[model samples]
Target: MVKPVNVGIVGCGAISAAYTTTIARLAGLRLTAVADLDAARARATAEANGTRALSVAELLADPDVDIVLNLTIPAAHADVALAAIAAGKDVYGEKPLATTKAEALQVLQAADTAGARLGCAPDTVLGTGVQTARWYVDNGLIGRPVAATAIMNHPGHERWHPNPDFYYTPGGGPLFDMGPYYITALITLLGPVSKVIGAASRTRSERTIVTGPRAGTTVPVTTDSHVTGILIHDSGALSTLVMSFDSAATRAPNIELHGEQATLHLPDPNHFDGEIHAHPVGGTWTSLPTRAGYQDAARGYGLADLTTTPPTQLPRTSAALALHVLDIMESLLTSTTTGQATALTTTCDRPPPVPLGPLEPRTE
Candidate 1:
């Protein structure tokens, strides 16, 4: 049998929980150690995940760590990932891979030079919600996908997050902060983006925290808080997307793919579970499940909870999607500022999704 991979996490922040919790429940992977600028936070996360606390240098230098998971904010992702590469460890980083495209490419290049693998997140595409949607589009359930839309909105994270200030920093705007998930999902369901145009602006210059330890504190918006963009996928499908921090919650669908014969309803980009509902050419609808709920929970929790099935998920979620989304966002911003469409260049190769399965009842 092949040995499990020993993974260390390089950031101990609010978002790290999602990664650590998932790692704790997986096989073929182990939570080897955790590192953070704040030693206490690293210790806490390390202990919680049954690992050790180390400084960034120590963690990277640890011989046992096969992969380093980078969950730092946008500004820190590239630096930490570069260090991991220098340490001869594979890396999985959270998105926007970097605040800029150049930095993202640098990280990718470093990984290549060091002979270390890189994985990035939003990886939402691997979730049943997206995989199921991909299957529908590929199978012609949604025939000749013509256009699609993906949307995400938040008033700002200050309302709930203990430290939401980063959401307003250089990399904190709606386009970078919450854009990756939906964008990655769109790319996966459709294909690589060939060109993009965007309109972006900051609705408010500053935001006040409504609730949290920092309640009443305020932060300035360093980037646009809202963005509307158009993308032309390589497959010739046009995609429109809206991301914002100024809108109140509404019933806007996460994604809707129009086709010559049918329409597809995709699930939320932030999660992996949902049914892909299809509207037939005759206007009738049917729902498809890529995997039952059991399949989703198993993958989200890591494959350890699974028993009956063979591996049904692609190993591309946690970092690969993040990197791809980072690349796409960089291109869009460049396209917007330069008033010209930009081709999203990339080298991340995700494993093909698990083979499509019978449309098992989603409720099961």
Candidate 2:
């Protein structure tokens, strides 16, 4: 039997709960410690998960931690990842990799120099929902991919979140916040993007908080609330993207891929699983069977998948892919400003598809 990898998590925020729960259930991973800027929160999380709570420095230095599961906010992702790599530990971090391409590049470089493996989230792709779609695409069910559309629209997060000020800030807008899921899924299904054209808008300068103690208080908007982009893939396929916080609702399927023979309506990339429907040129829509991806997967399955990967292999959620996803997003925003199509500076091969099965055999 393979030994379980030890995981030490930093950042005991809401996302940490998901990781802790996932790590507990995965046979190949063990949660050994947790840390946060808020020591009390860390202690509470540690106690809840039956793990130790240590200072960030202590957690990074601990020899028992084989991987640092970084759940820090966007601003801190690169710093935490670099520190973990410097400490000779592999890292798996939450999405976007970093707020800026430069910071993400730095983290990638540091990990390379340290010979540490680095992975990032939006691992939802590894689940059946998106992976099943990849299976069909890879099998040529779509028959010569032509184009695709990805749409994510909602009013905003302030409606429920207590302190939603960050949503209106530079790194908190819809594109940076939710675009990762859609864009990453697009890349996964279609392949890497080569160039992009973009346009964006901000509906209002200020928004009122609708719930929590901060209800009625207004937060300033510093970022675009509606972002649209045209991505030209290396395969000559084009993907249209719409990520918005300005819309009250949208009835559009989360994503759709058009090909020579049919169009595939994919489930939400934000979720682990859902129904995928296909419409042929002369036939009615039909559901595709769940044919790929980790069964009953969730947030941290990517990390678990990383633990089981051979040392010389890149995990499906490798940092290189995350960095390319980040670069695509950042470049889109830059294109919105420059009013010119932007060529991507980075790219990654499509991650290998997950075959239909559980991540590992269930223990009786």
Candidate 3:
């Protein structure tokens, strides 16, 4: 029997609820504790989930905590991850890995020094949607892969999120916030990126909250609200990306990849399952059958993937992959400033594919 991995969650925020629900359903995981700077928020989450509430420091030192699920803001990701690694705990966090590559390297190095495993999010790609698409590519259904396009656009998060200040800060722009899902999916479908050229702009200097207690309150926009880039994969495939908070909307598919033989319309990388349409060179568009990945998977599946994976092997959502994704995003921004193509300094092999199966505890 595979023993359940005990989880201690740091940062009791919006994403924590989804993870909480997922942990309760997974047979190979247990939600053991919860922590936050706001003691009340942590206590409420713990009470609702039948777990103990502890201070952030206390939770990190908890002997019972096998992994620290970091739901902290991007700025605090490295600090929280490093602290957990120091305490001999594995860590998995929300995307971007850290605010900058320098800080991300520190977390990776710390995890290595302590012999602790590390992973990060955008695990939605491990679900049936992208996996089925990956299955097609791997099986040569698309023939020789050539190019891809990833697009995401929204007016702004201030229209919905209660606390929208962070979304406008350095680490919270459209590219950093939503690019992980698309970029990770693209990498999974194509391969590691070798070079990137980018252009970006911020249409608004400030934005106003349209929802919650801060309704009508304005916040500064410190990062690009619109970013476009072209990623040249090592396999010679190119992926065009458009991420924006400035657009009112877009009717474009979340992601689409073209090859010598066919064109694939992929579902949203932020979602687990959806229709995957394909149009061959000489055939009309049709929905492909799902042939891979965890069925009915959700947010915390990556943590479960980490737990069931052999210690000698890397998980599908390994920290190395997340760091590489972060490097790509950071490099794209740097390219926007330099007006020259940026070569990637970090690279990772595409994560091992997930074979089609029910979402469950694994034993091997």
Index of the highest-TM-score prediction? 3
Error at 235, model 3, angstroms: 0.5
Off by over 4 Å in 3: 362-364
Off by over 4 Å in 1: 291-294, 297-324, 345-351, 356-364
Candidates' TM-scores? 0.88, 0.97, 0.99
Residue pairs in candidate 2 whose N, alpha carbon or C atoms collide under 3 angstroms: none
Report, for every candidate in turn, its global Cα lDDT versus the true structure. 0.73, 0.93, 0.94
Candidate 1 TM-score versus the reference: 0.88
lDDT of 2 by residue, 27-92 (tens): 888999999999999999999999999999999999999999999888888999999999999999
RMSD of model 2 against the true structure: 1.8
RMSD per candidate (Å) reads 4.9, 1.8, 0.9
lDDT of 3: 0.94
Measured by lDDT, the strongest candidate is 3
Per-residue lDDT for 1-364 in model 1, tens only?
4255677888888878877676655555678899999999998987887789999999999999887888888789899889899989877777777887778778878877886666666555555787777767777776788999888877778788777778888777888887887887787777777678887878888888888778888888788888889988878899999998988885878999999988888878788677778888877777765642224442223222121123343344434445567767877777778888777676345335544432121121
Off by over 4 Å in 2: 361-364
Which pairs in model 3 have colliding backbones?
A: none
